[model samples]
Target: MGTIDQTTYTLTCPQCLQTEKKKVLDKGSNYGGSHWQEGVDFSEFDVAWAGGGTSEPVITTAVCKKCNVPPSIVSSYS
Candidate 1:
């Protein structure tokens, strides 16, 4: 096992455009290691992931707490 780090993710609600930040565990080496692993904490949000054949886990559904909507995505850093 590798060291765990913290990563901040920004999410937005598609319905009301509300934004929120969440910190999750980022595993593996950050300094050019061959292996890297990370995951999204589903307990933090009402979210779902894409299934099958993909190289990585993709966020398929994310619900916003304020708007009760399910169109949230990991926002790009500014």
Candidate 2:
């Protein structure tokens, strides 16, 4: 019914603590009085191999430039 805001996902590498933008879905920080669940959904992409299993839920296709974090952390800040 209304407009969807752009969302910016932040991921910090556990090894280096590098922060990266996994995806930009909605816009605006405020939800315009809309109720949104904090960090509930996730959009997984193909990231680098961190020497872990594909289903480890720790590795992601989106790597942080600074810490090279995975995409799993994306849902943590939604």
TM-scores, all models, native as reference: 0.45, 0.32
- Going through the candidates in order, what is the number of backbone clashes in each? 0, 9
For candidate 2, report its TM-score.
Answer: 0.32
| Candidate 2, 1-78: lDDT as tens digits | 242433455555677655555433222234453332222223223353232221222333565454434534554323
Model 1 regions lying over 4 Å from their true place: 1-8, 23-26, 29-38, 42-44, 51-54, 75-78
lDDT of 1 by residue, 1-78 (tens): 463544455777667777667544434455744322334554435766553222334567678666677755663322
lDDT of 1: 0.53
What residue pairs are clashing in model 2? 5-26, 5-27, 6-26, 6-27, 7-26, 18-67, 39-78, 46-61, 47-61
Index of the highest-TM-score prediction: 1
Give the worst 10-residue stretch by lDDT in candidate 2.
49-58
